[model samples]
Target: MSGTSEGPTPATDLIQPNVTHSDATPCPGTEQIAVPAAGQTAAAAPSAPSRGGPDAPLPATGGTTPMAESAPAPAGFTGMDQQPSAAPRRPPAEPPFRSAFSAAPLAMAVVDRDGLVVSANDTFGALFGGGPEEFTGQVAADLVDLTSDPRIRQAYQQVLDGRRARLRCARRLKHPDGHPLWVQITVAPLAPESPNVLLSVADISARRELQDRLRHVQNHDPVTRLPNRTLFFERLSAALEAESYESGGSGRVGLCYLDLDGFKAVNDTLGHRVGDRLLAAVADRLTRCANEAGHGRTSVPLVARLGGDEFALLVEGSTGTEQLAELAESVLTALQAPFEISGRQLSVSASIGVVERQAAGTSATALMQAADTTLYWAKADGKARWTLFDPERNAHRMTRQALVSSLRTAVDRGEFTLEYQPLVGMDDGRLRGVEALVRWRHPRFGTLTPNRFIALAEEDGSIVPLGRWILATACRQARRWQLDHPDEPPIFVSVNVAVRQVWDSDLVADVAGVLAETGLAPHLLQLELTESAVMGSAGRPLQSLRALSDMGVRIAIDDFGTGYSNLAYLSRLPVSALKLDGSFVRGFQHEENTGENAAGQGEEHDGAAGRPSPADEVIVEAMVQLAHRLGLTVTAECVETCDQASRLRRIGCDTGQGWLYSRPVPPDRISELLGSRC
Candidate 1:
């Protein structure tokens, strides 16, 4: 649309070219962009981004041109006037300063001392939905849509007043779409001698979202979306402060640390995928319980995912250990049911460790240390239980942890030694056999018992090596005893086998090798199996026991009566001898009773109902006769007293072993006992 030129024409019409293009050429609003007035050329100013408006005139970049490497000022306006008068000025070829400023990358603006946007860049113009001229005399707060939060005006004013150099702030800017674009606004003095403040803004919407994700990962567990260790520690420390340091505060903080029991079995039997899913389900249930406990199912505690199958709960304002126990019970009850995952009904159990403290000594580190100790105790007591922290028990737990840490290298260091308790024959009173028991001369802990380390050895799979050493050492000693006492009968060596030792390695071969290496006959091995263990045999223990027994190994059921009540089932096993549990022998006495008190009216059965009454010579005699008929030699255990030894010998019992004979004297001690007696 063309119009005849008026004498004093409008400034925009002077640069608005009327040249038309064919369909092949770049169309209007595309490549043929309108230019600015002569005064508008090179009039770009640093933008007041925080103020949100266009500025006029970029401060000259030194004396050098902006395009020059490392230079500042644009090439001294050289090419501007070089255009010929007859060159038919087509908007100066490149875009005018006004149009370029309207599309500048940064939301830049120039604001006066009155806090009004005099001019701004294209990005600033787009940000405020106003032209540079229209933005003149407009206050930054007015241009930024600060109607919701006008306090943003003060943030920019501080920069202008020299109280702040660069004001960094966040605000919601009204976008062209009528929505808010979160922008990180940066406002500062534009030029050294200039009266305006330059505001710079960045659309930080995406960066803010990224920051939120990073914060989530930092503060919460990736698997459970619950507060993680770091965040939990922070919250716990705060809770403790509230309980102890806060004014008028008298409550305590309770912590529960739970680890899923048998979870590794699930992970190995099922896959890790199922294990992860099970963990998630566990987290959900735990979160629910933590919310309910003291807070009555409405208040949520600081539930944290402390990595792996472990989770922790922080209960603030807890009163005492009773509350701690209740929290632990809640956790145990919550995990008592089955979790269905990966198409399997997985029953998982957790060991909870509860620690509560009213004072400020409850540091995050201290609480975690105590909780961890308690958790271990719970697991040790048997899975699916909770253990409260006790200072005394913590000492033992710490000692055990120290021992476990050092146990791996204990064997190589020769810290372990075997002591043999000779299994003496009841009839002949001769050293017929020896049971090997291991002891640890721990460097610091000193003389550790089997109860202290054998379980640890089993856990770390060190039992395989340690057990092998035990067998070989015991066999070698047995062979030495036989050689040393050539005139004496061959003494058998009984060694207890760990289930882990049997399952993880070739136990039969290891046993055979130990016997062969020590030159001890297989029958002289007497590998004892408990009733529970012998009966618990499946494919491996069964095959292994059978193979060894086929090779002349006399299998004896050790610790017999202590395990199972069923004596009839023993006949089905290959057990040749029954090692009567020592507990049964503790009752042996001189006086004998046939249960008839004067009249034998089935006299009200005193405590002794099943077995013969106290001092029952007849009951002892009957047990021996029954065992002999079954071809099962009865070995009476723990003949601790002379009366006991004499009484057992008179009762027709086959053999016995206990402190009464010698109190499990070592080899040299055995040599001493043997030289003094039969």
Candidate 2:
């Protein structure tokens, strides 16, 4: 490889320190070329034509000449004084695209099918803190962090094998100088059939940072600087999922759904600005509570503003219901303090619903619903308290809702039937009439009594249709009983009607139509209403009672003395009967322990096993006398024994209806008893 100093030298002898070649010599008939050192630019101007050759260009300045130009001729010194027949054949020109690839602005590298970096442009080498030659033969996958993610690695492999067109993904990288960088890496085949792939990387840190900022804004509350409903729900859902608990966590979640009591009043009277400030203040206290609750735990609870005056604290990996209860109590105690807003001392309280359970089968929606129901219970039980979610209570409410939803349908489906309790005349011990009671034969919840569904029906207006059904059925049955017993005076039927039946329906028309359709005398039918319903009667109710009374139908007050007993309406209204409540009759019992007073056990008792309370006797006697003086018959309820009946009969009560006569029975049972007296 050495060359003599007097003649043109071989290109290998003049190789620069920065440049190296794998081949020692050129191929047959080809000449070797020299490359410049690093950081030295090649002169762009064309060299002057040689004087000894046919306008041949000189070699680049400050670099070795080509082998053909440096070699000495076989003839004597052919130099600037000698002219040749033609220009010497120049070494084959370097590939034009290679230079462009090296100069491209984009950071790029060429990786062979073996996943080794065959070559990298200067820009790529600079980007990764290395020179171009230093990157050669390195694993391209490691250089770009493609192997960190299996999905990206797989796609990169596919692109390397020419099985896939291209692959692009984002990656976070740390530079050697301790700074973070986000880059988008792309890999694609250099050509359709090429064995090499070109990998390109672009800086995307600014874009990622912008996206993170936007996401934060979207997931946070502006006023509280805490998570909003969106983020709360997201975290709740994640916590409820089984996967969230698989990482050695507690596998339990808890939530405290909180609402500021009387918040709407504050907004209405003090304006929304003050209301908003109060809510923000509440949020701050809630956050503090969450932080304190999370002490000595793995993670702090998430506090979020659900909207307006409502906020929630979500605890993942919760210990149990006890932890949730403690958290809820903390919230209540924290909110008890007064908030100073707009120079006014504003006082507010919160009602919180606490729910906690295993995360395996729970959902965010179910948890929130339970919490909401418990919160309503807290408010109803009186505000400024915390209520834990009780599955039993929730089930009862759900059953009530199910009953309410099906109440109207139950009527149309004929799922209801009547049971009649006998009312016996105290004087003659003869059956005076039967009080009609309604029962629902629910398919799912069998045999529901009036106490269970009646109020629900009343609330939803289902009582109107249900009451009409009861009236018509009772009248028709009573007429059948009359025809069955021609010898016995027709025993009357008394049906209980809700107050809503009077206000919501034409009660007089319904009663008159039923009597005409059943061919039963109006005197044989009586409608009983609660004392509350009949006490302050006026308007449509007063008119309805007067009309029905004029038609010969009797009106009676049920559960007397249990409500506002305004007796003034008795002289003006058309009420013909009074059914005293069972509580009064319950106290009218013979004393089985007459000697208890001597034993120092004498105390005012409920007559459970003692002598009749004198107060009850006097009250019953006065009511019975007042009722008889007003021309209204008296009926005593809950008469359970002959002694009680004797006491009621002595009180001059006209009728007694209780277990002493018979428990409420079906229509057929009542028919069996119609021929006999109590």
Candidate 3:
């Protein structure tokens, strides 16, 4: 009643009733009514009940006696006759409504249209640090911070205007003790015609605190406290979506995929505890680097730990590759210093792959893939560096992988073939031997050369078996040629050997078995090894070569001058021939004064005028002499011109191999050459 209308409308004007008597009660033919308070208008008052002469024993129309209308009215009650009661009725005992309002658990308050508190329950008063009497008449808006939020104010207004029956929101309340009180406030009109609102508040601070902790745990890494991969990917997706809207899909995005070099070694050698500490230190440094890099940018880069020994940075709206390169450089420089953990100074480096592209055509998956591939490239190109994404390089790598995957089966499928290149005597121009070059007659990429798949086989250890196959095939072919030309000098067949074959395979036994199976003389089957392989030969490798030499097999050092030309070391090995590298042969044709000296050999003139810098010629002449003195034959490789051949002959070289004689041909072509020589 206190907040029914502005200034408290009189009790008579507040209650409006259309009263009806209940026939089920013991009050037949009698009217039960609520008499309006003082100052009621006659039109608003109920008609006076007709008196039936002391109610005529209260007519029993419904088998019940009616109350006499002449009964005395309670004190302070106004009857229909507008007569004062015989005695002023004592004020009604304390109502149940007041007891309920006082006992309500939630903080409850009644706010009038003027936003003033008309009545507040004890809970409301106690919650705000006061009693009900002290809170009464206070401006409700000033008592709490709800109106500070426009949304809460709008909700309040909506309820006040009757547009909404109830409105609720969660907001922080201003407290007298200056402590924050989070609460859920609900507003509802007290009644259909009431101008007052029933506002209720419930504390929710504890729930909110729990939710905040959960969110932190979900989005962060436990070890580093940095955002984990989940949060990083979420942010990356958001940034990409924002770029699509902000720049018409033209914004550039960049990512740096990083892996710690030799992280496994650290984990294995130092134990996981030390590895964990090192990982934490690395994470901290990465976070600092990302922050420093984004100093002046609108969107800060997000650094996250993808997993063990792996991390990434998402750069939104990147300027270009140069910017990404700078970021990568910073990361590398930061990790250059040693990390002291558990009293041990551990030095580590990282390889980063950077990828930047227009956000319009790229996706998170594709971007991450490119970055990962680039990172592998960095590791492959010798760790501790950064490599940019190159589509061409990726394609090439994919092709190499495809070839490697197919190589093991290629041998079983018999897709491999061989071509023979003649090694012609430099002086006589006759074939002394033929080099067997392996080729892959692939079903997809037709006829791949050995250079393409041989390294793949070596890396995967498939070369051991492939090398055995080649050795057997070459020996059998050479035996056939030898048997066909019984009356002619036997022509030898040289087969290249991979280093892995020498180390991983039983080279001595394989060669011996192949020679016995084919009945080909070991001397007529030459095995050529690159200079590095020959120079690095030691222990078992050296013993294998000596064993082959003892078996009457020819051992030649191919590509001789490119590696460590340790003459003293070379003379001690079981070597029979040296094939001069082609790079030196290309310089031969350019030299003047191609005249043969007095001994039918090139002149040993140093810096002769009009002679192409005798540097290469001088080196070749010296090598030929060295080989001859060691009782080893010297073959000039890549001899493509008559001048090159003549120079080699004058330099006292034994043989020449190049396109000038004939490109590498099939075994049938070699057989034809053999027949012609015969």
Candidate 4:
């Protein structure tokens, strides 16, 4: 018999009594180990030698040792304990697996093939709020709370079937104390041939909470806790994409861009802190409105703050523009109520620009741009209102912008040219003067009249330079015509002056310079200002007009009677003529049957019912008398027929300018007419 060490080995003490070791008969040179059957006591086995130590041969059968004499009678002994002479006497001590398992920080459990927890570590018991004994015999799925997830069961089956070596997942576990535990779970086979699996769990609730916070911060605004512009755009893009796919190009999407009117007053009077609180309150109301708008519907509108006082709402799968209009009206109405901020009630209104369109061809950028433009329209049309996007109006604006952008270079490029409209004498039927009309021969759009781009030019202050160019060009042409026709009576050239040009530029100096450069007498160059513009002139503007008149420049009030006629001031002005507005001249075409022929060859009517109505004739006669009293000439404009000319001549009109004699023609045409008249 071989002697075994009497000292208790660390590996032997760690092994529980329930754990069984395999029993195998020893060969000639090998040692064999046996485990006791259930309820049976067995003799102690020999302890293994220390690892990496000198080897000692096992004792052979019948070899005497210190413990051989004390060996109990072997019961059901399959083989005698022996040691080989050539082999090592003892094996190295087994590793401290039991101690490591018991001391591990991770919650660990051994589960059988039947999904039962065979054993659990103290950490596992503490994590689940119980002792190891309580966890033992419990179903592994029940303890881990993974039975609800089918993937976990599949993963376990795959690992157990030798398909995968290990499986990992995060799961929520139920604690005995009713608290929830988020844990990362890893499963692996205990051994190659064993029907048991080892599960390692780590509590990760803090990590999950941190991730959730990060996601929330990324998707929500810190101030309002609402979705910010970033998230709003993302959702808008997604909605557009989904609509494109689902509707196959017919689905509609709408956006309402809101800007608080008088929000700046709040910030200026109060402070930014109060403004921030007010914005928060506004956001709350907007969110509630959005929810109410989307209540009982499948799709909910997304409302977001685009920064500052600008907020936008996106409506996906919108039915039509009517729906968007309703939403916009609701937004404006909702903001009508006063907001209470820091014990102060503040009132605010919003301008909403609504744009609804098919989602197929529309892009996020285009939609946003349109919405912004519509918002501008709302503000421009008057705040506290909503404006629907109109393509025609937008095109007009875009064309205006294009014209403005091209105006600066149009002068240098010679895109502008002058057309001359002969101003004929109403009585003599001969050309007296010509009005210089500026025309823009655009590269893209052809033959644009002044009405198309003049307002745009005036707004951007580009009219100053353009007006200078027109003045210089028209004077040069008139001077040439005068030089060419020295024997003929001098024909004055009338040029229209814009209000901004008169107010913003040095009109006296520009006219003086142009007249000197072109060698045209100021008397032959007439500057026509609209009645409204001239009537409103005062201070420096009135002084400038008087100065120009003193310089031998002919100052005429175009479109007379269309504005407030300050006849008292008009009498004092150095105005050369009053060009009656076309509206007044059109009255001459209305022939009443008081037995008057087209040639006015009937009963002589003085301010009576005739081709020119009695009232209109009276007004014209009175205006002509007033002008004659002031020593100013009267010119009737928009004369298209001989009857109108006859009536104007009968009314003592000195000049007639319209298509009847000839439409506005070029300088050469005027020179021809002048030569003919001469």
Candidate 5:
């Protein structure tokens, strides 16, 4: 009944329809009116309004009318105000409800009680990657991909049946184009008497990704962008049990453990930010290298970060130790390049220790132990290189392990012993003092050297206690020797101090107490330290060393050339002597073609292996000369023959200590050496 008018002059030819009114009256509240010619049917209504003109014709009904069919004023209409009669007006049109869904922002779908899609908003259509027309007649199940939980269907049915006020679930939706979107959907029943149910979906993809990102950060190191310990152990455990390796014959696992050399200097000199960037850059380079170096070979390396300045590669299914060695060499080569970080071109170097063994019967602890021990050797053997695990080295390690396992009880059991290596005066060959080295007489593994177990003690933090026992035992021996040779000059005792002893216990008090307990004069005692151990001695280190030195106790730099030696720093130190590293003296001696080592510069460092540069004997000689010039006594270490010791004595070296004098003999032998019996 609502439409526009068209022109029709004929009155008799008008058609009849649902909305027909022959008489034209003033519109009740509206100012418009429609009239048809007299005797005309609704369909034959005049096209134009007569406007009270008798000559006007009525509109015809193929929907043509002057008043737009005039709609019917109203069924109950009466003349306005009773006294002044006027026609009532038709009602105004209201917009359709379903049409508004076209522009809705949120994805929406209209479903019947039977769960069929009665309609869909553009957004809903887009959510399924289709148009409204494509979804209109589709079943609700058609829009929900296969990933939807079957349980969700029951929930959806509950929503449609009004058993639940709303059905909500978080699910990953599959798009028509195959990309997935995480979504939170709420399905609710529509209005009463409406056959439809409403589904409102929100794309929660970004939020889901945020959660995943948080999880990733939780397992990876921010500095290196490598999997940290948490993730490393996680993957290791998985590998231990995973079926992926089950398909092939079981192969042994190998590990390449590495530590950075001079990385701390870079961190201390440059800011940590630069260090972090450097670590990230290194991580990237190493990962690429590990993968490229026969990645899928017998042992493929899984590189991971293990805290600061440490990294590891897990070689799963390594064919043998050789494969791991190849991997290690590749890694070393990969890191040989200069790294540009924070706009600084810094040369970074690393030392790596390789331990390869069958994962069979090997616990993570065992593997880590072997790797760690080898790592120490790599560093001790000199930095910027790699070393493979040797069973011979491992046998030595097992002995040390036994010692460490027994160390905590050795003091209580009296299994700990000390053998003194005499520090002789190079000029006079007089005993300066005996550098006391501890040994262990294990019930199972015989006498053990200090090098065999000292580091383990240090690692387990047992050095503090073990070192105390060594000090006490050596002091007690010194006291006995003094009493035995009272008429002769009193000999001093030199004790090695473990770095841990300095940090964990009161070294000053410990040393003072030991001397007092033994009734030995302070001047008769000396403490030996490796170069690095004393390089940047802690404030406590300085205090302890000075406290002992002030009491007339001597302090000496042990293995001087092997560590980060800063001659300037040593000048300000309270040290009384410098023990040249063994490498220096040993390398300086050469045998001629008569099957003797030619002592020129000595063989290049690993020159046999083409690694670090050759050991420079001239440099060692220069160091000995320089130390004596500084009023510091020079002790030549590892002098294997009298000739080498003689050369050292000629070089003005203040002392000589090594195999030539006797391989660290027991205190009884020292008594002979000092008592003029040797």
Candidate 6:
């Protein structure tokens, strides 16, 4: 029995009823003793001499005492009235904790304040392949391998010194049979005031194995067995962080993002299954390329499949652009080879965008964005090539993006104005008609000419609204000129049209509406288009051109000789005039002189500087004659000198529009010219 004497013992603290004590009887005239609580000092029995006599009643303790019932004495003893000898009774049976500690199912041991093992249960002994008695005098930290780790050793010491309530950690241990075991160890004080601690160890190998398997499956791509996008971004973030914080590294990172060119065609022509096999093969080649690039390096590059046909190779601590470029080239060469799949040999090319830079100020999202844009450049430059990122080019692209985002809004805000370049009669030097040029009055960037943004407009289909605006404004200005200079003949206004305008909008309807709205006659308005747009015109474009021509609107081809200069199609199409490109006119800036004439009269012929070369003269003459034969007039552009104009007139050119007459001027200037002509 072990319990407190200060109060009646609780039933739970008493010795188990099942643990029977044998061959014992209470001494007569003595009170039954009470057990002390665990970890509490037990009261000593009254001394033999202190008791007045054997039959004398024991002195009363401060707390209530248990009384014994009268009963017959044991066979060898006298009746209940007999006095018992004062010799010290046999020491009370060993405390109950000993039994409980021995019978516990958990592997546990008791460690004294000095970190020595006081005792160990059978279960604890089996953990290290020894008997409980063998572990008793051993150092507890050494037995559990805690001494190897300084942090764990310190924590274990804290528990033994009673400074910490408990300590728990995990360890990888080797079993006596040579197999490895994963275990969780815990140490706690045996009692609130006791220096001894209880240490427990639990096996956790199965849980750890399951967790490892799940992590592998989560971070890898099933199709390629390569790290997936999640893991790829994770590693990239880590590399960037390390480059930013850690010392003594290259401080640069790089990536090669690529995809199989025309892979969709393969999937469409064949099947997805074949496409998948082709992608797998491509991944394998890319992996080998990465490994080859990593030779002699500290860390191998990571290859990841970022969904679909896209893949990326990440290199940490990259040396420079040269290293990344070498990797890209190797990838290109590897993918160029044909693959044999499903009894068919398929050939495919790859477009790779390589980006490498100092990792100091870059982020994962920004790096990926740069790589994607570079890949687009590679495709645009032509497939089967690798392109490195250029900051200047990216800046241009960013500016273009800004312009794109604001284009339609610019139109709605009326951020455009029209300028008219004079189209003068080659012989009379009189204004015949004016070509309408569009200018963007950008808020941030001062007035930009057509060359700066027209292509962008067409590509994005914003030219429809922009072209419509130009047409209406030019026609309105021409009508105003007609009213202001009544004495002069009304000159037609020629407006430039884009191919996209015909396909994206109803050109015929737009023209009719503008004419009707501005009260300008169709014959007084002309539409000028580049040769490339007008050549091989058919479908909606051909119909639109014919409709405009039939409405008495003039159709002139601008930049004629630069494109399909097929004069035969001139007869079949509804073209009204030909505007000879400036390149041909530039060739006439100087005349070729015979050797003797040039030597004798070099100074005198300086005034004839703009004479045409023989070949140019012949070509212009032939084209002018051929156009005349087809009932089409001719306009020569870029006429910058008097001699050039005179030569064009001599060649029977009908109109001249260039710096020679007037640069593209504002509507008010055209009004002044019209009034002056009147």
**Which candidate ranks first by TM-score, i.e. highest?**
2
* Number of backbone-clashing residue pairs for each candidate, in the order shown: 28, 1, 2, 5, 28, 4
TM-score, per-candidate, Cα-based: 0.59, 0.83, 0.67, 0.72, 0.45, 0.78
The models' CA-based lDDT, in order, is: 0.72, 0.83, 0.81, 0.81, 0.73, 0.82
- The candidate, 3 or 6, that scores higher on TM-score is 6
Better of 3 and 4 by TM-score: 4
* Candidate 1 residue 266 C-alpha distance from true site, Å: 15
Clashing pairs in 2: 8-70
Give per-residue CA lDDT, model 2, range 224-246, as digits (tens): 78899999999998888743559
Error of 3 at 615 (Å): 2.8
User: Judged by TM-score relative to the true structure, which candidate is superior, 1 or 2?
Assistant: 2
Q: Distance (Å) between predicted and true CA of 347, model 1?
A: 13
Task: Return the lDDT, model 5, position 593.
Answer: 23
| Candidate 5 lDDT for residue 561 | 81
TM-score of 4: 0.72
lDDT of 4 by residue, 159-247 (tens): 76767899898987667688777899888887776667888899999998898899879888777778888888998998899888894
**Candidate 3 per-residue lDDT over residues 155-252, each given as its tens digit:** 77788778888888888776768888788888887777676788888888889889879988998888777888888888878877777678544388
Candidate 2 off by > 4 Å: 1-100, 103-105, 129-133, 161-165, 175-177, 242-247, 590-610
Model 6 score (lDDT): 0.82
Q: Model 6, 487: alpha-carbon shift in Å?
A: 2.6
Instruction: Return the candidate ranking by lDDT, descending.
Output: 2, 6, 3, 4, 5, 1
User: What's the lDDT of the predicted structure labeled candidate 3?
Assistant: 0.81
Please give the ranking of all candidate structures by TM-score, highest first, separated by commas: 2, 6, 4, 3, 1, 5
Query: Residue 431, candidate 2: how far off, in angstroms?
Result: 1.2
- Cα lDDT of candidate 2 equals 0.83
Give the deviation of candidate 4 from the true structure as CA RMSD: 9.2
Off by over 4 Å in 3: 1-212, 245-250, 259-285, 332-350, 379-384, 483-487, 590-611
